[model samples]
Target: MSTRPILALISGANRGIGLAIATGLARQGAHVLVGCRDLSKGETACKALRAEGLQVRPVELDTTSTASVTRLAERIQQSYGYLDSLVNNAGIGVDDDPTLTTADRLQRTMSVNVLGPILLTDAMVPLLEASGRGRIVNVSSELASFGLRADPDWAFADFAMPIYQASKAALNSLTLSYARQLRDKGIKVNSICPGYTATEATNYAGNRTPDQAAVVAIRYALLNGDGPTGTFANDHGELPW
Candidate 1:
């Protein structure tokens, strides 16, 4: 086995912030696992990373699918037996009639954004515990900020994508709860607001690049054993709860 001290798994890593984080970690001598829904896209990403001489492996993981998540867990257990970091980066933003958002949309968004991560983390907790210094990075957003929701000047408040916003809020709450539960287990769990990253989900309206956002995620992923947990931060600073 290579003597690399880090092993990282990032979901939805075929492109955007997830891809950027995988590349960054791989460059830092970590064995990066690129978890994607599309096997072709995963292979393409893996080839690109390998071309750059980064240790990257592609793993199929559709976060919304329970079967996929279970298979992913099994594969990781058999392949590495431990996980140093897990970056929950998979999410979806369905554009339906804001006022008439159906229950299906709400369920879908919540499944992928909230329940999916919870299940994945639960499945991987054992592997993380095996690593003894594991870290969990939940890729949250500023829109999830309850404080921002209360403020009229928060810019995104008027945006009526309640399903997406609420899903992320639930994700942030899950992060805190999981962090508290894992605090004594030598694992650190934290949430990050990527600050309007220019990804497909945002229609590129975001000012910050995916690579820039990846930096913050990577920092949280590589934190020391005593680092802060159950917190939300961005490139600017820590966001108010």
Candidate 2:
């Protein structure tokens, strides 16, 4: 067995898809760091995983806060020294309301869904570089697809969450930029549309379970250096940009 223990960091992992991904990675023998804004929830999640004989630990992280991101970086540096994979899974949704929407709503949505990942990735680059087989997986959505957005025949047109859609689109662009910059550094960065997953965030409207989404994410996380970069995928195949 490869003794190079895979160190993975998953944000917003207290519950939902983030927690599911953490559990899946831990099951595969990866040392998982679960980042959550709530300490109690984080501890609970850690305990649940530990009970299953999985290696997991809770780390305090609020992606919207720069100070929190810096502190998380320092904590990881002190404990693990390096990270093999990073799953930028934290995100939020804005209620569909064109009349009530304000700049604050857009800002908050973008800050959490888009900017947060950028800051966290920037903070963890050194650790990823040190790993030599680094993988950065941004949990994007099908709503981010420009082709889908432009096509009236697309199913997503039936449900219009403009703020959330725009944020994911921005995240996809960020993934591309990062993948390009890190290409020479041996870090493979890619975006994934986990499909419509059933979670609290989605109010259980989705047909797929969180575990199903986690499988796709873990697959990307464990991919070799030769794997595709700057691409998007679901359970079936690659998606259109």
Candidate 3:
């Protein structure tokens, strides 16, 4: 709270957009914690960042497991006493085929993409409240934009990966709900639509790089007290809910 460096955590930071976000936040003088399901992978990522003379540490985290989320909250509570920012970046859409998706596949996708963040955010709220400057950034996608998808002229209009899109839409809803609820506590909660980026998740087909897509998330992570909350935006500007 004083002259100490900002303490931030970014989930799924082992690679791709999450890794880019961690690196970006670190460069901005924040002591970042890279959260990854694979400890070895996270260690590798952090090692690379540390080599750049950045303040970064790796933490083992599996977003889908309540035990994992709880453990992380506890560890941060003990080690840092408080957290300045929480970035929920772990997501997956393995079941992209809306028509042929089974209940199991839908459940798996939702568990990681929606339920995981909800659980983690709820767990981190206490630590964030301790910070007095808590911020939560939900990594979302424009594909979740009901407004854009409804437009006939929108690109990718004909494509609908129900499992993935629905999960992000649900995440957007969580952003609004959490922002309003945490307003009195002064915690800024908002959603960031990191555009389609060239990542393993996209099979490297997107036009932007992970670093390009990570800028908006870094911006929201470092928002001021007057910054917008309970809203959705991207690198360019606000997007329709």
Candidate 4:
């Protein structure tokens, strides 16, 4: 086993679930890179965590921009040379406006939630490969489960946010693809739903807190090479695809 301390990069870690994930990893002795679009907020989050004596660094990364994403990878490469984990937690939701065109909604939602992560992962895969024990955690949602949504008898079946749901569903697919492609490289990739966590994304109207949801993502991030890959799970356990 590599004696090197775990190094992780978490996107959109200024607040909410991303911040929670960063804190959890830092608390467990990992060097966490907190990625945020706004440098000030990222530094603030890093400062708060550092006050707790955790190893945390603020990284300004706008996942939606290739330039920003590339810069972050280069920074990480120069600073650490390798990364043990990546938590792609940055995402956004759009109003389910009937007046909005599908193209508009998809472009906005998929850009941040889907394309951004894919691009970042492509750029960072090399650094992750450098780590003997690499992991990737994509913070997904139960709402992304098509099986549950398609089930008429399921509770919360009435809950429907097309654009948001579609984005997560696609993320889940991407998770599987990366997991399979990188399995030989010893990189484990998995998707996790933080549950109905109360965050800005949900307007703080969720049952679970950000800390609660952070547990599941952190668990997968710290997994060993023998751990499950290409899977979707949460606090409760494995979720249906």
Per-candidate Cα lDDT values, in order, are: 0.90, 0.90, 0.92, 0.91
Listed in order, each prediction's TM-score against the native is: 0.94, 0.95, 0.97, 0.96
Residue lDDT tens for model 2, 150-239: 789988777777788889899999989999999888899988988888998888988889999898899999998579999988888788
Give a tens-digit lDDT track for model 1, residues 1-241.
4465699999999999999999999998899989999989999989978998899999999987889999998999998899999999999888464654488788788889998899889988999999988999999988878898899977887877778889999999999999999988888999998888898888887898989989999999999866899999988778987
Q: Answer with 2 or 3, whichever has the higher TM-score.
A: 3
Quote the lDDT for 214 in model 4: 98
The positional error of residue 20 in candidate 3, measured at the CA in angstroms, is 0.2
The parts of candidate 3 lying over 4 Å away from their true place are 97-101
- Could you tell which candidate, 1 or 2, scores higher by TM-score? 2
Clashing residue pairs, backbone N/CA/C < 3 A, model 3: none
Better of 1 and 4 by lDDT: 4
Per-residue lDDT for 171 in model 2? 93
Model 1: per-residue Cα lDDT at residue 173: 93
* Candidate number that wins on TM-score, 1 or 4: 4
User: Which pairs of residues clash in candidate 1, taking residues 3 or more apart in a chain or in different chains?
Assistant: none
- Which of 1 and 3 is the better model by lDDT? 3
